[model samples]
Target: MKALKHLNKYFFQYKWYLILGTLFTFISNLFGVVPAQIVRYALDLVKETISLYFLYDGFGAQTVVYEIFAFSILLYGSLILIMALLKGIFLFFVRQTLIVMSRHIEYDLKNEIYHHYQTLPLSFYRKNNTGDLMARISEDVGKVRMYVGPSLMYGLNLISVFILVVGYMLSVNAKLTWYVLLPVPFLSGSIYFVNTIIIRKSEEIQANLSKISTFVQEAFSGIRVLKAFVQEEPSTVAFTKQSNIYREKSLDLVKVDSLFTPLVSILAGLSSVLVVYIGGQEVMAGRLTPGSITEFIMYVYMLTWPMIALGWTTSQIQRAAASQQRINEFLNIKTDIVSTKDISQPIEGAIDINHVRFVYPDSGIEALHDFSMHVKAGESVAILGTTGSGKSTVANLLCRMYDTTEGQIKVDGFELKEWNVQSLRGQIGYVPQDVFLFSDSIKNNVRFGSLDMSDEQVIQATKDADLYNNIMDFPEQFDTVLGERGVTLSGGQKQRLSIARAIAKSPKILILDDCLSAVDTKTEHQILNNLQEIMKGRTSVVISHRVSSAKLADKIIMLDGGHVIEQGTHEELMAKEGAYKELFEKQLQTEETNS
Candidate 1:
């Protein structure tokens, strides 16, 4: 009942269409009832008498009999015609209404789920699969649409028809009505039991299907790796296992459904047979007329469809209920990160982290411990660390993608929480380790970073990122379409393009997270030099393992195990004989050996 309440908003919006459709269905069923009544009347009018009313008795009943039969035929024909017309009109409108309603529901549900995903942190996606999430948004939502459209209307129609038929049957023969209803409780109870099993099996099947989809999605995405490693057989085995599980669950669902309808039909049939036995005896004993018995049988037959429809509706509702629960679970998740409703005044790039402690929510492993740092406006600082040393965490905290567990972060002397998260992020340009590009023209990808920028501005950013020559080399130049995720470009080209995107933002602060790893040292140096001039008076945080990259910064911060170990200029660090000096000397020896 609680789950059904969710549908009220949509139902009320289209209530008028549903009301008209119901009215037409009722009228159609009423006309459908006429044939049985007409049969009973015609039997009473002519089953006896006959012989052309004993060869024209004048006013002795021949005229009366013929007229009664003629009127019955004419009345039933007209009702049938009207019913057919109404059915067609109602059906068309009902279909259109359901389609329109389902479309809106699908759109809104998908958008809500998608927006939730955006607010969720990177860790959430890292722990879940691409295929599983895709199935929930696509397949699960599709089931809800099916429920809203056809199942809802058909279920309602079934109830209305059942009520009309049952009432008419009781009026015809009260004894026969009791006989028919004897089996209803049993049949309905059995259907309810089967429905429970169906819901459980359907959920299992959907879960397995998600796993199978994930396997296929991952296999195709990493096809190159599988080929390189020559692990096709192993991959095939894993895929087959997932497929088999999905198949097994699906078959379990089918087995239950197969038994459900047959059992329901048998119970309904038993009731019909019992009704005929009792009503036949009544007619033989003259307690009820033959014409009345005929009408009762017709009503019994009419009852069968509604019975079957009831069972089907039960199954559909059960499946939809399960789907709704899963969808609701996703929609209810609360994001740990949310900006204040009201933003403070904008900043001019001074950032201070005061005694911050932070951890990934799910893992509870601290990524930063009592970390404190400060950067005045226009200061360029380099962060150096080995893997798992919190270099990226520092950048993420500054952007407020994840909130600190303990301590205050301030921008331009204002608390980070006081500023709108989006506005603060807008001021910081970021180039991540993995570069992502949409399947669009190169010009469009660059323009994405600054939608309202002029063409000259775009060209200048591309030149500064050292990607202008690469874009011009293609036949279509800046207008060339990149394949999915910019697959058409080499590693270095993709990295340079990402840098171009960041540069186009004209940010007050730039954070590059090993974004230049793919570019050669000479090109890296040239781009860094160009960036230094452009980034003047704009705070920057450059993260890298390369000493050459660190050389470009005004000061360097070295970290080890989520804690800062040293902070100084390159010359000062080399003179200090610490971790920085050791790493730089090792790199120098490697370069000399290569030379």
Candidate 2:
């Protein structure tokens, strides 16, 4: 019911269209019923001919009666043709307009969902499945479209048919109409009861469907790993289990639907039999004309379709309601990253973290406690940390992907939340660990960083990232198309491309999170050396697992368990004989052993 209310708001603006559509449908049904009544009259006229044969004294008059019957048939056929033409004309505009309206709704919904997704904290996506998100934006929105298009109109049509049939039936004989309608209450009760069960089953089915979609997407993405590890048998077994669950749920849906139509048919059929028996007796008792009795039976048959259509529409609406609930759940999630009121100053990259404590939203475990750091404008700092030492968390905080739970972070002497998010991001350049390049020309990918950048500027940026020679190697040069995720490029080439993208932005602050991990030691050194010259006087925060990479920084901070254990130059850290010294020694020993 709540879902219906939500869907109704989208259709509210088009209420006039719906009213006119219903009016046309009502007129079409009115013409439709006339043919059935005409057939009843023809049947009575044939019955009269049996007795009138004595007065005519010959079968020649039968030709004239036959001609009269043929003309009646032609008139009913003409009425049917007109009704079809009118319904088609009305439906043409309705369907065309409604489809356009549906497309508009779909576009707005997808845009809002994507915008909301972009503003949400990184932790939200970390806990949610990518496939499920795709399903909501693609499949769930389609469910809303189904309701708007067919289910809504079919539901109204059922109502119109019911009113027309019932009114005509009651006008013929109120007592007989009551007897014919006796099965209606039972049918209605059965439908209401079964709908509850169907809705519950549908929710479970939808959940399992999401799981299946997630599994398939994961399997395809990790196909290379599965083949390398020879895990095909296990994957097949898992896939079979999910597929079977889907099959079982689908069968349950079919079973419930099967019961619905038969039940409605039985009730309608029972009413039909009662009307025939009771109305036939009224004719024998001289209380009703034979033609009137035939018309009553015609109306009963007409009632059958409305009853069936109503039940089917009810079931479809219930499924759509379930889909709507899931869709709204996604749409209603609060974006965890938003700016506070009364703040809109341009940032200058002077970042300060004061007694800032952080926790994961789902786990509530502190990722960083009493962590404090400061970066003066145009300062270059390198962060060295182990696998889970909150190195990425620092970068994410600076990017405003997540907010501090227990302290304050300031940028340019103003609170972090006080800055406009877009302006802040626009001023910051981020090169992530897994370099991603769209399947586009190198020039376009570079220009994504700065949309208005000229080709000459892009060539200069590529040269700064040490990628100019590589781009010129291809016949198409800057216009060369890379495969998805730059699959056509080598690891070093992809990383260099990302560096070029970041440099193209010419940001005030640049945070590179292990973006050069794939490059060899010599290439890494060259890229870092080039960045030093190009990134001079820009606030730079480098996150790296390798000590050699941190050697280029003015100051290196060693982090352990989300705490900064040491902060100094390479010589100062080695002289302290602390965690940093031990890590440096271990790396030297590993290198010697590998040699």
- Report lDDT per candidate: 0.80, 0.81
Give lDDT tens digits, candidate 1, residues 480-558. 9998888899999999889888878789888888888898877898898888887797888899877778977888999
Q: Which regions in candidate 1 have their CA more than 4 angstroms from the true location?
A: 1-8, 12-28, 46-75, 284-289, 592-595
Candidate 2: segments with Cα more than 4 A from true spot = 40-73, 88-94, 97-104, 342-345, 570-577, 581-595
State the RMSD for candidate 2.
3.0
Name the top lDDT candidate: 2
For model 2, the run of ten residues with the poorest summed lDDT: 49-58
Model 1: lDDT to the true structure = 0.80
Residue 519 in candidate 2, Cα distance off native in Å: 1.2
Clashes of each: 0, 0
- Pairs that collide in candidate 1 are none
